[model samples]
Target chain A: MKALVWHGKEDIRYDTVSDPAIEHPRDAIIKVTSCAICGSDLHLFHNLVPAMLPGDIMGHETMGEVVEVGSDAKGSLKKGDRVVIPFTIQCGECDQCRRGNFSVCERTNRKKALGDKAFGHATAGLFGYTHLTGGYPGGQAEYLRVPFADTTHIKVPGGIDDEKLLFLSDIQPGDTVAVWGCGPVGQMTIRSAILLGAEQVIAIDHLPERLSMAAAAGAITIDFMQESVVDRLNALTDGKGPHKCIDAVGTESHVDFGQPDTVLDRAKQMLMAENDRPHVLREMIYVCRPGGVISIIGVYLGLVDKIPMGQAMNKGLTFRMAQAHVPRWTGDLLRRIEDGQIDPSFVITHKVDLSKGPEMYATFRDKADGCVKVMLQP
Target chain B: MPLTNVTGVARSEGDPRVQRKGPSSLTGPDRLARALGWFSVGLGLAELAAPGRLARALGLDDKEGLIRAYGARELASAVPTLSIDKPIGLAARIGGDALDLATLAPALHRDNPKRHNAAIAAALVAGITLLDIAAFKGVKAAHRRDGGAARDYSDRSGLPRGAAASRGLARKDFDIPPDYRAEGTVADAIPALPS
Candidate 1:
């Protein structure tokens, strides 16, 4: 089988590889159909988190068909069934799964626990996350072995078109988390504040494309590049601040502020705490209403410092973190997708083949490509 | 021994490369394999009764290794939800199990004139109930890992839930003290003031 493999920084190549077969009774073999390049994968290209080794298929977001099942991989998931996988490969049993922290399922990432000769690392494993994701061969290939398949992969409803449902891999859950994380999960979170069943959902980002897409999604888009989000955002709301706020613009994501330096101000500082770099996350926390919600969906690799613990403490503010539990909510998300409740397809600014990922990565890394997401085929 | 075991594997070609792949698919037996795979605070006698079958079904060649591995790493890998830090999210998480809105229509709410005021709160509750159904009732969104699979009601593995009283959420500090979930809270947090 041929697959895209990551070898060192900027060294991803499409190469032929061995066929995947079921090794565990619980394992299922999947013939890859489609996958997507994630912002986290870019971290590997920059060597930020390390271990972009040779022949490592680089991707986690995926959908495919069950070619074989290890008997243990059950629950009506049989040959020819289509499935969408969550970023974390988990066994639906265990204290973690019972608690919905499927990301840290006991069987998935326990390095020391699984014994000397085991499936993968002990830590929560991801597809093609290199060291972070247990170095599991990703699905950007022809055939792949899906361990704990029944637990990790959710079968999609038949008859749904592939192109529209693709965002379920990560983005759908991410968007859901934006609201869920900020509101209902607790009080005084940004997402709930900005989104509070408000007539207009206001969003602030430097990226025109993402901001516009957010606007199209019912948010009143504010370009931090042109005007300050805090000041200008009020006009969108009734000067009460956004009812809910979601910081989907992650650390690696670039915003095109009108300022020449394109430097981030409160937006970036509050979102993250630094050696003390702070912005986006904290800003979301800072800006929402007195009892509003703030949802932080940005990706982070390091510890943030000097968080507004005081602001969070005094205001009785609530904070909700983002983890895209897509597998858990796939069916509900799909209904929403099908009914046109949310159309994330608008976020797809560029389309490219699996072979063109490397070039797209370079372009995205340099912030030159207008690429927001790149879809791949196996 | 548990830690060194994996680094201690004897190589085999047919053995899984152990790299990540597309979101994989599942069969019926895989659900059994996944659930039975966990070894809780002591496997108890249940795991010992059926050794080989369970081991084979779960894809584990080393049973003792699994026990040790689960014992050593279980505390961390396991997502423990605490009771104290749980109040709000727990309420929301349990929305799936809560009473039907239609049934509670009388006591929880009275008739409305314009209905806009009551509708928003009702909508929020409805949204929470929907998510609770998805989150706790274990409904997978109608999508697959690889864009090819479909949803099946018969495809369920187990309950989908979040950590409420054990393995607390990572974002929050979980030093909530076990007693919080046990003999938690004094009565009357909800004021007795009349509406």
Candidate 2:
């Protein structure tokens, strides 16, 4: 099998690897048909997250037909079942899973001791993330071995295309909501807010293409490079600030001369003094209306420098964040897709063979050639 | 053994292992930059640990302190060179090369006892200087953004229904999950005080 492997910082390789087989009673092997290069994968590409050893396969957004199912998983999954594998792996029997906090579901991290040392408590195992999250080989290959397959997979219908079904594992909107970042996840968030009845959705980003796509979703766009986000957001909201703010850009905020703080954050990041750049978080706290909500959907790897907790406390803000409780909403979103309410395929700007996954990582990271989201076929 | 075999204690017998390596995301220039960065570390350590030996060999016995300072400079340049920001470190190396040549010029004089050794060191520095220049330019060119305008994606709304028609469409069947609601309905539910 051929898979994209993480070699080191800024080094991904399309390498031939041994085939995966069912290793546990609940495991299932799938012949992967589709996968994606997520924005968060850039973190691994840049070697920001720790515990990423060489030869680890790289991908999370994946869907495919099951070729083999272990004894325990045969009840819920079987051969020829098409399913979307969520990024976060859960046991579905833990107390956390019972309460719908699937991202923190217990009993999944194969390397729990290492995960506990790094994160205080081990969370759910994630496909292709790092050793701290199970060190499972990712789905950026011809086949993948899914653990806890009976509960971890989202069974999808055969008729729909892979693109529409893939983002289920990866939104709510409020009135006068402002979303930071306009990548694929951000773009989906924009449409979700509009569909959920937000009177106005403001999208923030520097890329013209991202801004334009947001506008097509009827969102008013803010090019952070061209104008002041704080000023424009306030003016749009009649000086009261937005009722809610969504952060889709996490950790690696764009380092630009305009956002001098981002420049400093990048310097600290290079020096190994900081793990995350919280420029977006800082701005969201500053610009959100008092008593409003702040939703974080972006993936932050570890510690962040200089967050304004004082302002959030004074304003009585509510912060909601997690790796998606995939099964909790995937079913609902799939129905919506069936009903023609939303289509997620629009976010894919590039589609190529799995062999080209290495170069696509570079292209997507640089945001060059007008590339936005990349979908890879294995 | 493959790297995975050594580090993959967590992996099971059935898990995938590397069979053959292929092309990497790192370009030729990026690999060159990394090699030079490691070279900088080696040279820097030698200069710092044995400045007296280096000075005596080059007939700069009186300039031990200066040689030590150059060692510190080499180590400093190596940091950025080894980092994702290679151009900065490469530029610094180019500057340091000029300094090395200037310091070695007087050592090449006919009267100097180690004039022959100084010539050899000077030639090495000149060779490194050319490699530094090439790596610097190659890195800059390889990582540069496309010179074309960004493609516009205004036609992609992702909403099958028009944006206006889709607003509040899900509200008919869905409500905000109780724990997720920000503005509390509990506050509104309470009777207001008489005005």
Write down the C-alpha DockQ for each prediction: 0.02, 0.48
Per-residue lDDT of model 2, residues A47-89, tens digit only? 8887888889999999999999999999999899999999989
Per-prediction interface RMSD in Å: 16.7, 3.9
Q: lDDT per residue, candidate 1, A251-306, as tens digits? A: 44332344422234323332222312235666666665544445555555554554
- lDDT by residue (B1-195, candidate 2, tens digit) is 422355554554566888999999998888888899889889888899999999999998998989988988998888788877789899999999999999999999999999999999999999999999999999988776673246788899999989889998887887566766655532222223244
lDDT of 1 at A230: 65
Give per-model TM-scores.
0.57, 0.93
Local distance difference test values of all predictions, in order:
0.49, 0.88
What is the number of backbone collisions in each predicted candidate, taken in the order shown? 103, 0
